[model samples]
Target: MGNTYRRVLLKLSGEALMGDLSYGIDPAVVDAICAEIKDVVNTGVEVAVVVGGGNIFRGIKGAAAGMDRATADYIGMIATVMNAMTLQDSLERKGVQTRVLTAIEMQEVAEPYIRRRAIRHLEKGRVVIFGAGSGNPFFTTDTTAALRAAEISAEVVFKATKVDGIYDADPKVNPDARRFQTLTYSYALEKDLRVMDGTAIALCKDNNIPIMVFNLAVEGNIRRALMGEPIGTLVGGSCGIS
Candidate 1:
């Protein structure tokens, strides 16, 4: 497979690390993901990952349970840092150079996020994992991925979801749901598609960053995406497919 994007931001949901389990990180699953990332890196593609904390904690859920929104979100951010460290360890075990960068200051665990420093890490063939979800209460990791992609001038954001691509409805719930090969940002917003949150999608739209939503459950899909295979739904380009 030929490499298409020079640099790409991969958005991995925290739940994806759960594998067959219902909660927390699964070691086998983490190893598999790191293997995929290693393959992508070996192909000469610069990779930056933004991981979510939904598996460990959901800020909205906590807020609904009477916790302060800001405090719940901070807990969620810390969860992401934990996930990032786990992923970094797995990647390093596979001989891939990795760095964990957190938006919130955690000097003992990770480097404080700096745009130029992150770019430098990528230049040196190090995989940079961005944790902590933009270091804010309201922003989701999806928005963080979009922001970092723009900052690093990534060619695209590969959002690894359980579903193979973006559909009109949830495929798991609606068997008849139709999947789109391509979509415009306006169409996605108008249809209220859950491809990504509104804030995240809007950020990509404003930055002209294309997003490819694909299934992480499918083995080797990450490498396929890095090679520019037509494996998932591509959003925001001149061509629009409804």
Candidate 2:
């Protein structure tokens, strides 16, 4: 039928923008993702995106290397801002109006995050990309996605990752691991599936927001997910594992 969601929050890992590169963004990959988003926007679905910065710098890894944990996390947040700007540029090139709002203040580059302003932009049919990971230490972009989704009253969170779906175990390590078509939020949390950080999952669970975890590398997957094509794992529906 028509699109399955009216407004949705998309969570994109920085590594997904890297393509086959070892580090940094791949222009081609960004363009492809932007094109997919543009198509979805044309369908009248309001879109907001939260991007991670693992490709450029990972706060946890930095902290492990002896850097100040909070400082490392702040750097990571800045990295996410870079990613957000790149996404904005790509989306705009494709004729989709885009706005970048950062949790951290960086007026020279982007507007500081304002909940009302972001919601207004979405209402006006503009793609709003949230950057800077909530402007706090130790919080993940996934959590930011859940928080923003709740703030904007989004129907679902689209978590675009490298894997196609969530499996009982790491699919790469266990070939026999089964992928669940649907899962309860409690199961996901109890199993520690890492569909998202526990905080993010709990936030979504509390808000009763569904999360669709799908492969970002596959072209048209975003559109497929929006159309409710069952392309990946679905979390927080029916209150049980399936």
Candidate 3:
């Protein structure tokens, strides 16, 4: 099937890379995700990724425990680069061209992030994995995903999470919590659904970028989402019934 999006940005948390492990990346899980990504790229859809660092270290948690916020965040940023490199290795092993661009300069390891260069790589059908969380301490990877999506003119942002979609309440805790197939940015923010944090959601809202939240654990979901399958909650613009 043809993809509905020409270019897309995928947001993945570091915890997602952990799979069922307690911490750190699980090679098997990264391989599976990369395989899915390779499949989408073969279909001629440009893909960019923004991965988080919660599994290795969370800056916020460190700060809460008395570490300097900026220092902790910088360390967190480095952790993201580690994740990006791992993803790049996996994708390349699958015979897919991939680039690891870091917000912070890492000449020996990866190329520094240049907006036009990143776009050019995407245009050439190479997967670009953006690491280091915007080169700033205060930003989250979610915000980076939104910012990069806008900068790259991605057609949509796919937020691959553990949950299938956004729920009225914690689906794990509330068996009856409802899932909205579609949601307006205002509603998601007003209700604080934590879809991608306030900054990320607002960035998407201002740019009119749609976000599709789906379960990454479900095999073939990335391809399904690209096909415009209604398997997740879409957030952006207006939804008549949501």
TM-score for each model: 0.98, 0.98, 0.99
Q: What is the C-alpha RMSD, rounded to one decimal, of candidate 1? A: 0.8
Off by over 4 Å in 1: none
Error of 2 at 213 (Å): 0.6
Expressed as tens digits, the lDDT of each residue in 1-242 for candidate 1 is 57798999999999999998899999999999999999999988999999999999999899999999999999999999999999999999999999999999999999999999999999999999999989999889999999999999998999999989999887889999999999998899888898999999999999999999999999999999888999989998574885
Model 2 local distance difference test score: 0.94
lDDT, each prediction:
0.94, 0.94, 0.94
Model 2 C-alpha lDDT per residue in residues 148-231, reported as the tens digit of each score: 999999999999988999999999999999988899999999989999999999999999999999998888999899877998
Tens digit per residue, CA lDDT, model 3, 104-193: 999999999999999999999999999999999989999999999999999899999999999999999999999999999999999999
Per-residue error (Å), model 2, residue 211: 0.8
